[model samples]
Target chain A: MSHDHDHDNELDPFAARVRALETILTQKGLIDPAAIDVIVDTYETKIGPRNGAKVVAKAWVDPDFATWLKRDATAAIGSLGYTGRQGEHMQAVFNAADTHNLVVCTLCSCYPWSVLGLPPVWYKAPPYRSRAVIDPRGVLEEFGLTLPATTKIRVWDSTAELRYLVVPMRPKGTEDWSEERLADLVTRDAMIGTGLARVPA
Target chain B: MNRREANSHAAMLPAGVDAPVFAEPWQATAFAMTVALHDKGLFSWSEWADALSAEVKRPGAASDGHDYYEHWLAALEKLLSAKGVAGKGDVDALAAAWERAAHATPHGKPVLLQNDPSPTEGRGGRIG
Candidate 1:
């Protein structure tokens, strides 16, 4: 069946390149296989989207927790036992009716993978990364959000050591919602300071 | 190639290699994050797109995924260098350490991508 053939073609080129680099570095006595194994195991199995979701879920149900998360996200996130590479130091910014927040890793694709999983391609793309910090208001408009002129805007540039998450303002009429239900409203962009969680219909 | 044949052929290449399936799930996740932030009044899409296009047009811009990663690594190095986090010697030492680890491990075992979400692989776990 064509399906079988189609699957083989799906092998990741990025994986292939990483493997090839590993082979070369190993042959040259540059890197140890054990370290690569540790990296692979940690990122592939231990940390991912689930971790990110957990943080969002907790914040939705607990206001104090959410406040703490915004003040010091690394501590709040660590309280849930989701600390590791790419998420060692984290921060959360809150976006509200009077203020807007956005995040960009202007340098490299440094992200809170332990919380958000691997960054999306567009996050790693040249467009969002470079423009986010320069003209955030315009970018926000493209996503279908238009803020009032009186609202203050804050843009964060993520670095290798610290990653930022955006705590989107809770959608209206969700006062009695459960954590899981509220979390469902948290989209990946909402976590990254691009959008707000949507209110359920 | 016929439409189906072309799609089949394109499907055979690794993701991001084929224009059709060019975006990996992780890439989509990042894009969604950007979109979400924009939707929440973080930034406009046009501003972000324009900035990214400018970055692409920069002199000696990368042409492929490999080049892109390399560029990213270089940018990281520059940031570290600026911060005095590590001198050239420190970077060399880390690279040496990574090489040692890579070589010591056994072959045959696959190096899985960080965001491969296949169900058969037991990856379809809790979403959050």
Candidate 2:
């Protein structure tokens, strides 16, 4: 007999069952709807990606600070007073002109929300997740990032306790740029090591 | 209790062991926020997604709302920590404050539920 699993990409039976259970809890009023709202809003708004931008900007302007960031990301970040829940221990890597870096939580989704915000659905997709660690260069290529054969590719897998971020090299011709302007060029992917910050004309 | 009664009672409890209408939707919100930040040049979309996807694919991952938020929060923390922008303590303190505020006004007005786009709406072109 053909089982329900034969269906393509549909919600699994277990998932449907869980959805049904959640519906009942919502109707029963055991959990407060407002509380849930608070949780969601807090991450979406009050917390922002500026913190991460600041880090990237600083690294670009100050080489010493960039070295400090890569060496002890947690303590250096703590100095900025941006610590908490999943960000207790952090590490930063620098992707230079000759090297490309990417981060993945192969085991789980560990990210830096205090600075970068929430994750996108594609990040949770299976194709990117499975191929990221196995062939970092291939995944980068799909994203239109081609690293030279000489460029070292480093991939960091996130754990429940430790999280990682990539600090892409500052683009050339930004020597006289202000911190804010430099920050404008720092993208979330640049920090995550998947891509580089684009330069403006 | 009879099997039918047990089944009915099971239905009485919330699905996924978390608030359904409120919780399940946050994942998309989190996804959008991250996407918006990336689009605004705060970070790259690929790296952000890679970090979070790893968490969702973890073994024994909780199929409930709590697991979702916990992982999302963890992802945010990891990203911030990696950039040397924030520390774990900062997040914990904020979470503690949130808990206190939540308890103080159990019946207070809803927050975080406003201005969310519909599921069908485009997520700022980050995801295909």
Candidate 3:
């Protein structure tokens, strides 16, 4: 349902300053930091991975969207109201029965925040960046996502100009489910290619 | 904005851009502070550029363009220190307070801070 759901408050000075600056700016009245905080909180907690989940769900239910996602991800995703910044350029890779897709930004954390919200801290750390390319299977294993031996893994490295979203395969036994219900099954990591969508419960 | 400042920022930022580049709320604040301060005549764009370039070139800093914001923060700190604004001492005191506050804040709650005594307030109190 999420990525590294811990709320560890051991913030760095940079992280703390923005929080401080929020106070500093609120007094200045050029903009309301509180309102911005509401939006940021939504993206961090409520909306974070949910945007990507909706896109995945739509792709599953709408064949046309899936086709478009495969052919032209930028427009298809943008049409869904999930477009901006680091995600200006995008490619959606589907997870097939035999092939699994993974994403990483080795140079820096170029995540689709417009859809995925802020990336987990681990994603930006040195270990994940180096190990993701060196041993993706091991990385997946650490995240507790173990793909079968027959499945092939494809890793996409996100760049400043181009980013990627992973579309996990639809779970079984949910053929009659509503789109909203299906979206609830998509976790942030699923779209990050670190985990699979939830199995029907 | 000064002509030089405007020219530099335009060149640095992408063109025809409709992007939400800030990953977190704080990032947006940090970014806005840069622009707002620049417009307020606190520092010239050229000065900012020099500080940022020096920061990027500083040993042990990541020179890649991905961490541009980190460099942005560094430049802000450098400017703050040199101008006798909120130097490292003031920022550090405030930063430590935030660490404690953030640590105590519950999960799913907004991290808020209260003004506390650490570095004495007012310009030049901590800086000078």
* Two-chain DockQ for model 3: 0.12
| Candidate 3 wrong stretches, greater than 4 Å | A1-39, B1-128
As for model 1, its CA RMSD to the true structure in angstroms is 13.9
True contacts kept of each: 0.00, 0.03, 0.20
Once fitted onto the true fold, the runs of candidate 1 whose alpha carbons sit more than 4 angstroms away are: A1-20, A24-46, B1-67, B70-128
Chain A structural similarity (TM-score) per candidate?
0.79, 0.80, 0.81
> Candidate 3 chain B, which ten residues in sequence have the lowest lDDT sum?
B9-18
lDDT at A37, model 1: 51
lDDT by residue (B1-128, candidate 2, tens digit) is 12321232122122321122223553444444444344445456556656665566677664332465446545755775676544554434333333333333324344211112221232211111
User: Candidate 1, what DockQ?
Assistant: 0.04
Docking class of 2: incorrect
Task: For each of the candidates, give the backbone clash count.
Answer: 40, 45, 2
Candidate 3 lDDT by residue in tens digits, B14-88: 221212345444565665565556646667655665665566555564322346567667777778678766556
Better of 1 and 2 by DockQ: 1
After TM-score superposition, the amount by which residue B84's alpha carbon in candidate 3 deviates from its true location, in angstroms, is 15
DockQ for all models, in order? 0.04, 0.04, 0.12
- Put down candidate 3 lDDT per residue, A1-201, tens digits, no spaces: 113556565676678865554444455554464556555455545546788888999999999989999999889988987776322488899999999999987765667766787666455545566677888887777666678988999999876567889999999999999999999989877898877888876
lDDT of 2 by residue, A11-59 (tens): 2222322222222223444333445556566665666557788888988
* CA lDDT of every candidate: 0.55, 0.56, 0.67
